[model samples]
Target chain A: DQQVKQNSPSLSVQEGRISILNCDYTNSMFDYFLWYKKYPAEGPTFLISISSIKDKNEDGRFTVFLNKSAKHLSLHIVPSQPGDSAVYFCAASDFINTGTASKLTFGTGTRLQVTL
Target chain B: DAGITQSPRHKVTETGTPVTLRCHQTENHRYMYWYRQDPGHGLRLLPYSYGVKDTDKGEVSDGYSVSRSKTEDFLLTLESATSSQTSVYFCAISDDRELLGDEQFFGPGTRLTVL
Candidate 1:
């Protein structure tokens, strides 16, 4: 069973345009969410994240909006750059500190293309 | 760009062969994880180690095992390779604050092709 889902396989947008990537989850226990950017032949790097308590979080040019009521979240990149062309993965975790098995559940991923 | 390294970045092996992938870290983090990335299955945790010799099975632990003798090294071994096991393997590391909302750093990944 896929606990997390990224419906869009790929997306393309022009430079300086806003890019929105969507993701969904079925589990309600997930308390923290994260997005990672991966490049070819390289490991995924941390992008941004949001907590269940908050509905939105923003970084320099990236923003993550979480809708706990709908079990959905979206990543928005303002003025998308060519360097943003890569695969973005959405991950959810229960975020516990009990020392039990704590792991992040990831979505399939969405490939974003920033065209000039 | 965390201090994580995965050895044998690319390998081709046959069925029934035993293969071991190594992950080395320099950050001295307490948490280490092994994950496989496939087409449909985004990334599934194989097994993880919290400390030296302390390990636990992840969601998908069949046909695979892991060992962490030191804080810097974590090894994933396939007892008997299968065509189904062919995928890109990633090793991630995080500190004790992982559960407190810290992100994990991933390795470059190892592509294993089992025929």
Candidate 2:
């Protein structure tokens, strides 16, 4: 079963504009969410993350919004640059404790393209 | 990009042949995991190791097996390759599991093809 879903396969935006990618999860036990960006021929790298206790977390150019009620999270990129063009994977994990190991559930991913 | 390396970056094998992929890490992270990436299927976990000699099966661990004899090395073996098993495999590492998902760094990845 696919606990997480990213209905959009791809998205396009102009450079210096805002880009938003959405993800939905079916498992209610998940307590943490993360976004990873990947380029061609390379593995994904960590971009941003948000805890269930919080609604929004922002980095320099990336922001992650988590809505626990709806079990949905979104990644927002402001003034997106051409470098931002890549596949974005949304992942979630359930909380146990600081010492316990948690496995992540991932969505299919959304390919974002930024053009100048 | 992490301190991890996957051997045989690209390999093409025939069906029913035994194959092994190696993931070696230099960071000495306590947690290690193996995942496969396929189009429209995202990343699916195969198996993971929490500590040396400590391992567990993931959602898609049927045809795969993993072993960790040392803290820095994790190995994945396919008993008999199948056409459906062709995919890009990634090895990830993380230190602690935080309230918000801990960051897991991925290796360059190994692309395997079964003919």
Candidate 3:
């Protein structure tokens, strides 16, 4: 069963525009959500995250909004740049301890392409 | 990233051969995990380790075995290679601070091809 889902496989947007990527989850037990960006042949890099307690978190040009009732979360990058072109994955975890087998469930990933 | 390293960055092996991938971390974090990435499957966890000699299976652990002899090293072994096992594998490390909500840092990943 896919607990986390990123229905969009790919997205294209022009530079200076806002790029929005969406994710949905089935399990309400997940208290932590994260976004990671990956380039070709490279490991994923942590981008942004939101706790279950909050509805939105922002850092610089990136923002994450979570809606607990909808079981959905989204990442928005304002004034998207070409460097923002990469695959974005949404992950959810249930635990806070590292030694407790806290496994992260990832979405299928959405590839965002930004053109000038 | 988190001083995590995955050795044998690229490999090509034939079916039925035994293969092992190594993940080493200098961060000394308590948690380590192995994941495989595919086209439509995203990243699937194969195994994870909490401490030395303490390990557990993830969502997909079939045809694979893992060992954590020390805090710094985690090894994943494919008992018998198969074409379906050809995918990029990633190792990640994270601390125990759950309340502060730290994120997992990933290694560069190793690409394996089973012919």
Which digits, one per residue and each the tens of the lDDT, describe model 3 over residues A45-90?
9999998999999999999999999999999999899999999999
lDDT of 1 by residue, B5-87 (tens): 89999999999999999999999888899999998778898988888998888889999999999899999999999999999
Compute the lDDT for candidate 1. Answer: 0.92
Model 1 chain A weakest 10-residue run by lDDT: A94-103
At residue A103, give the lDDT of candidate 2: 79
The candidate 2 chain A region of ten consecutive residues with least summed lDDT is A94-103
* Worst ten in a row by lDDT for model 2 chain B: B94-103
Error of 2 at A73 (Å): 0.6
Q: Can you tell me which runs of candidate 2 are displaced by over 4 Å?
A: A95-99, B98-101
Return the DockQ of model 1: 0.63
Q: Write the per-residue lDDT of candidate 2 for residues B12-110, one digit (tens) a residue.
A: 999999999999999978889999999999999888988899888887998899999999999999999999999999999887664324778999899
- Return whichever of 1 and 3 wins on DockQ: 3
Off by over 4 Å in 1: A96-101, B98-100
List TM-scores for all candidates, in order. 0.96, 0.96, 0.97
> Considering every candidate listed, which one attains the maximal TM-score?
3
The structural similarity of chain B in model 1 to the true chain B, as TM-score, is 0.96
Which is the leading candidate under DockQ? Answer: 3
A82: Cα error in model 1, Å:
1.3
Model 2 TM-score is 0.96
